[model samples]
Target: MFDFLRDPQWLWWLGAALALGAIEMLTLDFMFLMLAAGALVAMVAAALGLNLTGQFVLFCLSALVLLFFVRPVLRRRLEESTPLAVTNAAALTGRDALVAEPVTELAGTVKLHGEIWSARPQWDGETFAVGERVRIARIDGATARIERLPA
Candidate 1:
């Protein structure tokens, strides 16, 4: 492994790029893609006969440039992408969730989108029966604050 670092082949840099990209699939955060681009640039530098130190420096510069300058522009462009049809929990304002079990005045749980989540009625003191429909008020950490839906 360390020997490959000394050799600094283009394939090694390309492999690093691919590995970073693969990890991004699980994380879904946009940070890794920048590093991947950097690795690709380093690979090209290595192909051009640059030494390992030069390749590493090129990679660091590429990553820094992408993160500081390119990332914000790309993020802005992607922000206007077509909205997902399904409402993610983070986007769950005014959405409805079914109560899978009775909600006591303090706390309870509900089923939404095939997932069980801790829930609480919006008002200071309230209780809800099972099978009732509730409107999502807001989410606090892992808990969903909700209220009984209007008939």
Candidate 2:
């Protein structure tokens, strides 16, 4: 009726694995999950009547193997599955910009996304007056290539 009281090491290991797994849900770092896997290996060893030392050895070995070998592959697979997010200059394309200084064929300045930037007209003959609204064609190095807004 009280067999667990005589031999409870496996139950202790199972408890540890469950605790680590619960921590994994909060952290999402995968470290606790790997440790949980190790604890489970130790739990299995205990259930098979292995001594404490053997169970510990299995836990350490399995944890190291899973952390080093499996973790990288899992991280890489997740990153590969997700598409890259557009940022910085790439994200600025097609967005609106306000001409801060008179823009001409050669050079000018514009306020884009709250930051002042060097700008140029998309066409050589075009020009933008101060405070004129424009559309960003693309980013050229540190400069913004701008076009006129529709009337």
Candidate 3:
């Protein structure tokens, strides 16, 4: 294991790093890509005739720099709290839905996005008719709060 660490070939390390990065792309997770970058740095150091200890140190340093410093900045730039409604399940949050089942009182269920969701009228006085269009106010966890929408 340690003997292979002394080899001055970059192919193995580069391949491993690229493979990890590709996997990360599919998963959309950052950790694997960081590790892959660390491995790449180690690969380059090894190819430059650096000792095993030096290569390992380079790998650790690069990995920490990416994980601690780079990832947080990247996350701040790219983070999306509410992703676009690409799937039917996600579309229910803001779309108009009908009260399939009568929610006689303050609590009831509405059918939206081809699924039933627990709903409550936004205002205490507002009453929704069955089959009426109600705009989803917001989604909190499994519940979709709704309010009557004007025509």
Candidate 4:
């Protein structure tokens, strides 16, 4: 009754595309996005009566092409459009900190971004009184080297 029927990939291809797209969203990279595009291409091939082997071949070829060629262009464009954000310990540099204890050259504590941080003055005799606002000079290991802001 259905002699023309061949590959049944309606749900398979659609599911693969959705799954890859979701992963791409999490990773924010174009790798899985290219695979999703390939899945869509294979979905079209399947709808056109291509066999499973042909669908698979097209999917691989399309995915490789998109990954190597299209992905770079897309990723570069996106990076060019967005400004880079500082992160990690480097992000704490030059930020304000609230002294939670009397900070001396040796040791103390401060509230940095709602978290308590071990702090020290940059100079040998510099000291920060409790409730003083100091600037983070740099992060050394687990400690934040602080400096008094210019008067």
lDDT for every model? 0.85, 0.92, 0.79, 0.91
- The regions of model 4 sitting more than 4 angstroms off are 1-12, 22-28, 50-53, 78-91, 98-102, 107-118, 129-131
- Superposed Cα deviation of residue 123, candidate 4 (Å): 2.8
Sliding window of 10 residues with minimal summed lDDT for model 3: 81-90
**Model 2 segments beyond 4 Å from truth?**
1-6, 87-90, 96-125, 128-135, 138-144, 148-151
In candidate 1, what are the lDDT values of residues 76-133, reduced to their tens digit?
Answer: 7787785757656668868888898787756789887788888988887798888888
What's the lDDT of the predicted structure labeled candidate 2? 0.92
Name the lDDT value of residue 134 in candidate 4. Answer: 95
CA shift of 113, model 2, Å: 9.7
Question: Using Cα atoms with residue i matched to residue i, what is each candidate's TM-score against the true structure?
Answer: 0.52, 0.64, 0.56, 0.63
lDDT (Cα, 0-100) at 20 in candidate 1 = 98
Clashing pairs in 3: none
Best by lDDT: 2
lDDT tens digits, residue span 31-149, model 4: 99999999999988887778889989999999999999999999999999998899999999999999999998777999999999999998888889999999999999999999998
Clashes of each: 0, 0, 0, 0
Error of 3 at 117 (Å): 10
Task: For residue 30, give model 1's deviation from the true position in Å.
Answer: 1.9
Scored by TM-score, the top model is 2
